[model samples]
Structure formats: C-alpha cells, structure tokens
Target: MLVGEHMTSPVITVEPHATVSQARKLMQDHDIRHLPVIEHARLIGIVARSDLNWPSAAKVPPDAMPVAEVMSGNVIAVTPRTTIENAASLMLANKIGALPVVDEEEHVVGILTAADILSVFLEVMGVGSGARRIEIRLPDRPGALAPAVQCIGSLGVNIVSVVSAREQDGWRSLVLRLATDDLEPVLTALADLGVEVVSTGEGDD
Candidate 1:
C-alpha cells in the first residue's frame, strides 16, 4: 500500500515560535506523540513528546521556551506517493517514531506514525478476523506454495489471506488465514501433501 492511503491527513502542527508548554498542550489534547513544526507554511522541524521531556526542558520554563529550542531541525519527510514499505524503511533506518508527509513544495500534507504502520501490519496479517490461522514452512523455490494452497482449496476451505516471509536455510514461512474455524481437515490435507505445518490457531474474533 502507499503512504497516502494510510497516513493521517489534516495533521496538527506547531510553529517554531510556539512555546514548549503550548506544544505539550497540543499533544496532550490530541493524544499524539509527534508534531510537525511549521513556519511560514513550510515544514521547519519536528517535535515529539520525548523531546519535551529533555533534561534541558526541565531547566527552562516551558511557557517561555520556544518549540524551536527542542525541535529536531534535521527532519526526515516523505511524500504522499511514497510506498509504505519505503516509508517504513526510512523510519526503521532513522529510528524515528513518525514521518511527516510533504508535497513537492514542502508543504505539510499528512503524517505517518508507528501506530499507522502497525495497523497496516495487523490488516495484512488478518488479525482479529475470526479466521483460522495456519503457519507453514515451504521450500524456497517456485511452485512450492501453490500445492499447499491448492491442497487447502481442494478441501473447500476459503482462504482469507496469505502472508509470507523468507527464512534462513532456504525456507519460506507462510501464514494463511482460512475462513473456517475447524483446521483439522486443512491440516490433514497439507500433511498429505507433505507440507510442513508450523502451527495452527484461530484468529481473534
């Protein structure tokens, strides 16, 4: 998915001249951790709840200290069209909790937080879908997954979703969410096909 599809738009922002107390209030009111610092319609910096907790912040009066003093000027931002994967990579590489989405003119359009990414992950995993989850390990080769999937399909079990990841030692891990609760039949089918069954459980209701 794209960042535009998941990012929170109409984002809240703070100006550089805004007091630290004001920024803290904004975050508290919105129940948000990060705020993009804007100035003259441009993204100037970013501030987080953690930034407000800096030791220096305790030394100064929050009402008198400007957000610019604690805000991170070296900001990393993404665009609406940026892929969610790329944006996630940027967050991981920078060890940041949020990323501001900007347009070509560097105008703040939206924001992507760790919560948003986690939501996408849960969606992809079909969590809380009330389906039966089956995890299997397959050979890391073409056509390896098809037979297992087909075996489940042949049992008249509806597949809700399929997610895979590469593992070490030339094996691929697959997590399949099946629509039915009874996984015994599906498990037997896969076992009959010599597929390695990692685990099976029911998804959250």
Candidate 2:
C-alpha cells in the first residue's frame, strides 16, 4: 500500500503567525494531535499538543504567543506516492507521531500517522473480525506454497491473506487467513497433500 491511499487529506493547518491558543482550538475542534504550520502557503513547521505545555511557554498566555515560537521548524514530510512501509520506517526513525504528505512542489496535501499505520497493519494481518486463521508448516521450496494454496482454493475457501516467513532450517511458516468459518475441508485437503498443519482457530478481533 502507498501513503496516498491511506493518508488523511485536506489537512487542518495553522499559520505561523496564528496564536498558540488558535492552534489549540483547531486541534480540539478537529480532534487532531498534529498541526502543520504554513507560511505563505508553504509548510514551515509543525506543532503537537505537547509542544504547548513547555514551562517557559506557560508564562505567556497562548493567545498572546505566536505559534512559531513553540512549533518545530524542522518539519519532516512525505509524498503521497511513498510506500506505506517506507513511511512507517520514516516515522520510526524520526521518533515523530505524524508526517505531512506533500506534492511535487512541496504543497502539503495530506498527513499520515502511526494510528493510520496501525489500521493498515490490521488489514494486512487479515484481522477480518470474524475470519478463521490457519498456520501451515511447509518447506521453503518454490512449489511448496503452491500445492497448499491449491488445496485450499480447490475447496472454494476464500483466502483473505497469505503471508509466509522463513523458519528454522528449511521450513517456511505460512499464515492463511480465510473468510470461511469451516476448516474441516481445508485441513483434510492439506493433510492429503502431507502438509503439516501447525494450528487452526477463529481469529481474534
């Protein structure tokens, strides 16, 4: 998945000259934690809720303080076309909560956050609320997964997700999330193919 496909668009913004109190109101009204600061239609900085609680900042009422004083000017932003995984890595590396999605001319178009990444993670893991999960142990050979998948496919089971990872020695761990509740046919088919069924059960919500 790409950042553009999941990032929040038409982002709420605050001008650098805007008062900290105004920025706080925007965050409160929109229920957002991050505010990208714009200057002359260009993104110049970003501020988070925590940025408002500085000890020195408390001396001046927020209404009298310019947002630029507390906002971080070293803004780290991403593009819409950036891969979801890459965007996530960027967040981890920066130790920041959000990234502004920018256009070719550096125009802020959207924003992505760790919360959005969590939603993507749940979808990728096939936490389909009521789906069933099946784990199979297969060899790392190229054709190993094909036969097991073919077995489940032949039984008309809708595979919601198919992810594999290398295990000890030559083993490959296959996690299959299915749309069906019944696992008898799929289990039997895999058994017929001599595939080792590691585990099977209803998915946790």
Each model's lDDT: 0.91, 0.88
Compute the lDDT of residue 47 as modeled in candidate 1: 98
Whole-model alpha-carbon lDDT for candidate 1: 0.91
Instruction: Give me candidate 1's TM-score against the actual structure.
Output: 0.92
Candidate with top lDDT is: 1
lDDT of 2 by residue, 126-198 (tens): 9865678888899887787888877788889888988884587999898889878788888888888999988
lDDT of 2 at 192: 89
Per-residue lDDT value at 92 in model 1: 95
Candidate 1 clash figure, as a count: 0
Least well predicted 10-residue stretch by lDDT in candidate 2: 52-61
Q: Which ten residues in a row have the lowest lDDT in candidate 1?
A: 196-205
Deviation from native of the Cα of residue 88 in model 1, angstroms = 1.3
